[model samples]
Target chain A: MKFSARNVFRGKVKSLKKGPVNSEVTIEMPGGLEMVATVTTQSAENMGLAEGAETTALIKATQVMLVSE
Target chain B: MKFSARNVFRGKVKSLKKGPVNSEVTIEMPGGLEMVATVTTQSAENMGLAEGAETTALIKATQVMLVSE
Candidate 1:
């Protein structure tokens, strides 16, 4: 399943916050901005994603539909 | 930016193939097993995805790892 999203940023996994059914993964960009993504523990392990690991964050800018204050 | 894939199948956009940089979205599954995605016709009219609408195909199945002939 290859999705065609723009490779917004490539960064290193800065932290992994555990959650009930999912985990919050934060990637630290070169410019210092952070992008947070949510993935299942299963996915995290399967992707071998962990703090300090290199990864790219693909984002369908449009899918980012909204943001709330 | 949210990415917590695993929605697997919930299709409708039955065809829209036109590629160069990217564009090859085909989603049609109802136990029928057909999942192919590759978007960008400006993301098919900014997610106004044609051909019957109703979208949902988030797959992180180990990134579909690999495939060969």
Candidate 2:
């Protein structure tokens, strides 16, 4: 999909944990790097998300924050 | 900081584009990989974020996705 967000990563859904309002999703990339995302419970169901399903991890650079030690 | 979500990348601030409400920030990782993020104007200024500054791009795996062709 054509998206304005610059970071679009390919990953497979490794696991899913549902909560009252939000769901925790883990996607592991080809490089073996893992990322975790939090989405609303409704959104997860709407996406028909399931374990082992291939999906795109869309991260808006704007949502990224910089921290220095 | 100890963050619950995974995928914390180290990078340098490449540029910043400010809008009325949101600001676009670009960070370049060590391998020359570039990632972009969007933040609020207030948050950007509050953080005193500027170009050429070192920062951490925090991405939750949940924010990431996988897509197949």
Candidate 3:
């Protein structure tokens, strides 16, 4: 599916940490890059996310911040 | 400054497109990976973003989504 998010990394679910309100998901992408995402617990369950699952991490351009250093 | 965002990429500004409310900033990072970010025009101006400027793109874990494909 095509979306507006500019950053999309295809990866495998490396870990899952479920919390009351939010769940932390870590995806292991190519080149050893890991992307972490936090989603609502409800959404996490709805998606049936589990470790070793293949998923794509999406990040909207607007959500990205430019930090000058 | 240290931030909570899990994804931090250092790159040079390759291009900038300004709109009424937002500006599209394209950063070219190592390995030829290009990341695009949309920021408020005000913030873009405040940051003085331009071509060839070095900046770090930050994306929080909460702002990311995982999609199964």
Candidate 4:
């Protein structure tokens, strides 16, 4: 699929935790860099996300915040 | 709009820089929080991203990385 976001990472699904409205998904990238994604339960179900499944984490730079003290 | 991904932040557009293929957008959130987003020039144009424009930065948790040192 074509997307406008510049940051995309390949990952493997590590775990899935269901919430009321969203489901928390853990994705393990290379070098053990793990990321979490909260998606709608429907979306999670549609993607068939499960343990050991391969997926991608698409990110927009605007979504990232940097803090310095 | 119905998006499967969770994590949304409301902000005003701080700046928009056009690149060869992609455009960099800076968004300022509440309480001085700022975030940067890189999108395709076409996408930028489609979204009408510009200075002072209000926008929402949609992020999936899977897109965020954490490091503990």
Candidate 5:
């Protein structure tokens, strides 16, 4: 399905830390840039996410925040 | 405040498009990479965001999704 998230990166699953409700999945990009995402444990299981699996990280534009620095 | 989101990039406001309820903001990074974000019009006004303004983009890990391709 097409997503409205502007930031989409292709990466490989580097690690998976599952909890009761949520799971933390780390995806390593081509340049070794790791993106950390927190997803529901059910979704993770549904996706059958595992180490070395190819995946794409999706972040919605509305979910993004701009901070003055 | 420190954020839990792993992906954080410093950029300058490239453009701003405002609607009745939401506003679309585009920030340009140092290397010309642009990140788009959708925020509430109230927030845009509260932050006093304008063109050429420097800012940081924040995204929560929980808000990120993983898609298998």
Candidate 6:
């Protein structure tokens, strides 16, 4: 599925770490850029997001307001 | 934002009914079609989805499997 969000990044699942509350999935973009997101375990399982899996990280442009260095 | 999902429907909020746990928001599409979705009240308020508001209902094509009448 192609999402229309302005900041669509095609990435590969670098790692999957399960936490007590939520799972932290990291995606590595083509240019060595990385994005970390928290999602429900069920969603992770449903999406079949695993290491080396190709996926798109979707975030509403508005939702991605700021970045802290 | 334009989404690239296979099924994209432009819809308007017809009604916003709040439940104790979740909110039931009904969206009316352009061709007199309607889709009912359940979302958290916080998400609704965050998205500013009020009656008469224009919004896009996003669901992964795979997520929308089938409908049984």
User: Which of the numbered candidates is closest to the native, going by highest DockQ?
Assistant: 3
Best by TM-score: 3
Give the share of true interchain contacts found in each model.
Answer: 0.21, 0.72, 0.84, 0.43, 0.82, 0.00
lDDT of 1 by residue, B1-69 (tens): 234465556778888777655677788889767787877776666566777676778776445677699
The 0-to-1 C-alpha lDDT of every candidate, in the order given, reads 0.74, 0.77, 0.89, 0.82, 0.86, 0.74
Residue pairs clashing in model 5 are none
Per-residue CA lDDT of model 3 for B1-69, tens digit only, reads 788898888889999999999999999877676789999999999999999999999989989988885
The alpha-carbon interface RMSD of model 5 comes to 2.4
- Candidate 4 residues B1-53, lDDT tens each? 33456577889999999998888899999999999987889778877777998
Candidate 1 residue-wise lDDT at A58: 75
After superposition on all C-alphas, the RMSD of every candidate to the true structure, in Å, is 10.0, 3.9, 1.9, 9.7, 2.6, 10.2
Could you give the DockQ of candidate 3?
0.71
lDDT value for candidate 4?
Answer: 0.82
DockQ comparisons of all candidates to the true complex: 0.18, 0.47, 0.71, 0.22, 0.61, 0.07
Residue-by-residue lDDT tens digits, candidate 6, B8-65: 6779989999876567899999889998877756667667778998877776444567
RMSD of 5: 2.6
Question: How would the docking of model 3 be graded?
Answer: medium
lDDT of 5 at B67: 93
Q: What's the C-alpha lDDT at position B36 in model 4?
A: 94
**A15: Cα error in model 2, Å:** 1.1
- CA lDDT, candidate 1, residue B10: 73
Candidate 5 displacement at residue B69 in angstroms: 2.2
Please list the residue runs of candidate 4 whose C-alpha ends up more than 4 Å from where it truly belongs after superposition: B1-69
**Chain A TM-score values, per prediction:** 0.79, 0.90, 0.92, 0.91, 0.86, 0.83
State each model's TM-score restricted to chain B: 0.30, 0.92, 0.90, 0.90, 0.85, 0.80
Cα displacement (angstroms), candidate 2, residue A51, comes to 1.6
Clashes of each: 0, 21, 0, 6, 0, 4
Q: What TM value does model 2 have?
A: 0.65
User: Candidate 5's residue-wise lDDT over A1-69, tens digit each?
Assistant: 777788777889999999999999998876566778999999999999999999999888988988884
The TM-score between candidate 6 and the true structure equals 0.51
TM of each candidate vs. truth? 0.56, 0.65, 0.85, 0.54, 0.78, 0.51
